[model samples]
Target: MKKLVFIFALSSFALTACSKPENKPVQESAQTAPQESAQTAESTAASQPLAAGDTAETSLDWAGEYKGVFPCADCEGIKMELELKSDKTYELTEEYLGKGAGKEFKSKGTFSFDTKNPSIITLDKAAENRKFFIGENFAEARDMETGEAIDSQLNYKLTKEAN
Candidate 1:
């Protein structure tokens, strides 16, 4: 077993050492340049900010369902599903895991972009819940009254689900 391990390690080092470096960087190579350019174009599209009343979806199409399990203080996590429509309506279904498992809460309301920041969406006054910072592919959950991001070990942003 020891000899086999040593042989494997030596062979791996020899193969790595024998490999030659490319003359140009991968991004600049002919074969990879087109792919890299496409990726750069997509990144540029996703980075552009959307304006209020534009009625156009974000670069990655923000009109969809976003689901995530957010960190919770007492419970295991809070499983949430938020659906944002092009018509400016939203439906949020949340269930607290573990301790509050069977109890699900659903909040349906109209959403509007924040007056000062178009990317930040606020729920109707009735919901009185947190706002979401809209991005290309995800909406980050934030504190309602304070507008501060929710601190958590787990990812606080809801990932978009494919239709």
Candidate 2:
């Protein structure tokens, strides 16, 4: 009788340990289905905002190379090269000439233009003495190089390079 009781107890313990509860499978399935549906709904909602922000002209059309030359009385020739990116950002390289012997002084800066008025370019440097201005065309940039006022004839105009 003792042996039979011990065998019965051992069998019951093994069956209980090996068998999963009746509600476990249903609970797991319910939890996983909701999580998956929530993720799908979130992803579908997230994509709408990105699509809304995208328009036909979302990117700047002015992304290209440009060059300009301004005649300077104090310098040999003011030559400027600009590389514009689709994000409305640009890199500007300028060479200034000394008044008499055509000595060249070079400088560079990063620039960005307002999306509303793409013609208005803002230039900044690490030195923190920055200036902003608006121009109708590239040639109208009076403050391209030095922020100080220069002679009127020293105005520079930017021209888009032919593809």
Candidate 3:
């Protein structure tokens, strides 16, 4: 067993010691590494130009009144007006169109922007999870409980009204 081990080790040493570095021409893959890296950097810059370390919370002029008409199943439509202030506060007014003309539902609360996702804001209410996706001069209503984007084509977008 000792003789077999000694022979195996000697053969392995001889095989490895006899190997030499190749003197072949460089491949195209090695030459284009810098080009590929530059392309990667350019693509990254182009893709994230609006979001490259600039979230909606930090980069947008978001403090204004946004008005929109949301679809309602039991009524004509829901007229919603939301104003996000600079002091981390919000005012929301909703009116069911077909239900009544002057019957407005009003609420005021403090809202917070999500730190991890920077575009999502949650209304500071305990009874419900009223979240909105903050965009450039607009806010879109999200799901009630999960804060996910509403998967409907009924135009949940609210446009920023000029103040």
Candidate 4:
């Protein structure tokens, strides 16, 4: 439709107009030529590496296998294993034990880090909503919908497996 095209064009123009150019020179300079040159050099150095906007907060190492036994009401426990790979994919396996017939289930899918908190990860296209709060040598399960950590003495937690 003409209105939709107009809206799309308007949105693109607004985004481009508002976005800041990385290579733009600093407006203020020092009084002396030597100081000015030094300032420019510093500015350029600071901007060069970060022109693509890579930051430590957005990049984290969370690749490993985690295992634990979760408490279950009717069964002895639920044995859980989760593996996260560097390519943002994951494998999850679960086994219900001591319920007359032990059953195992495995799910494989891609995962993504939460934009607000990179330490939190969620499974994509999974049958059951699952979220993990990643920490040193451990990944803890949280409320699937709210992403809030469950509070208990015997918390549902997974320890990283030895490489």
Candidate 5:
């Protein structure tokens, strides 16, 4: 009976010793997870700023004959011809036919950009106000003609047309 009691006490000690501790170092590392994440975030945020000489080159690569049409619901169909100049300015001529009034319009404008996501082009013209949304590969513009708002968006795929 004494040997049996000794064996039972030894088994109990072995079981208790083999079990995991109530406080683990692995779990304590998990508690510091938020601090590690905050440090990573701070490091990333500190690394992104526009350096000097980061200004984009502004030139007229848009010197071509662009044909556009306004497909608005309540108005006549309008046709536009945009001639871009070598000096980053533009000449706009438009013709409207179908419903409200029949007229031809002409304007001259200069464009400038803002380098945010989906950049902007501000057009200063003689008879109309215009704004263009400038992207990496394409551009679109909205303008007012004879007190009517005309919005046009174009996605350009460059191809050589036969002369």
Candidate 6:
């Protein structure tokens, strides 16, 4: 336990030493900032009511089932049903429409929101890094290769089903 504590102390010291140089400019500016300007900035910030920025990530009731028939090149269409849970897990089922003698393909896995863009989600281990852009009442499937919203006239959208 002594060795472990010493290693942790050394790691903390190294991290603090590495970060101090990068913070020098910000620290210098704060130290030299005018007192009156700082007071004015604080008062201005306090006077204005804080705006609640409600984004899709924070506001949308997104945990539910979504279903739609997406366009397919080889078959008539592809019917996909997806269920998103609050625990960052998902259940997906797909069936090729008008393709006879085939069973519904089902898969379940954990999903994660994009770190930089929380409005999008990608299911773990999905083919081609399949992603979806979540929006109001829909989760649109994005292009597998480009990871962008599909721009075709044919709808690739899944409508949220009322529970």
Best by TM-score: 3
Which ranges in model 4 have alpha carbons more than 4 Å from their true place? Answer: 1-60
Order by lDDT, highest first: 3, 6, 1, 4, 2, 5
Itemize residue pairs with steric clashes in candidate 2: 74-99, 75-97, 138-158, 139-157
Q: Give all TM-scores, in the order shown.
A: 0.61, 0.41, 0.68, 0.62, 0.46, 0.63
Worst 10 residues of 3 by lDDT: 19-28
The digit string of per-residue lDDT tens for model 2 on 51-109 reads 52343234324556667776866666777676656664556666775654444443355
Question: Looking at model 1, which ten-residue stretch has the lowest summed lDDT?
Answer: 51-60
Candidate RMSDs in order = 14.1, 15.7, 13.0, 21.5, 9.0, 20.8
Colliding pairs, model 1:
none
User: Which runs of model 5 end up more than 4 angstroms from their true locations?
Assistant: 1-46, 50-60, 100-102, 115-118, 142-163
Candidate 3's C-alpha runs over 4 A off are: 1-38, 42-53
Q: Which parts of model 2 are misplaced by more than 4 Å?
A: 1-60, 97-110, 115-118, 126-139, 142-155
Clashing pairs in 6: none
Clashes of each: 0, 4, 0, 0, 0, 0
Instruction: For model 5, give the 10-residue run with minimal summed lDDT.
Output: 154-163
On TM-score, the stronger of 3 and 5 is 3
Which regions of candidate 1 deviate over 4 angstroms?
Answer: 1-60, 151-154
Error of 1 at 85 (Å): 0.8
Note the Cα lDDT for every prediction shown: 0.81, 0.57, 0.84, 0.79, 0.56, 0.83
- Residue pairs with backbone overlap in model 4: none
Q: Residue 17: error of model 3 in Å?
A: 46
Q: What is the model-wide C-alpha lDDT for candidate 2?
A: 0.57
Model 6 per-residue lDDT tens digits across residues 13-91? 9999989986997787777777768889899879985444445557888899999998878778888999999998899
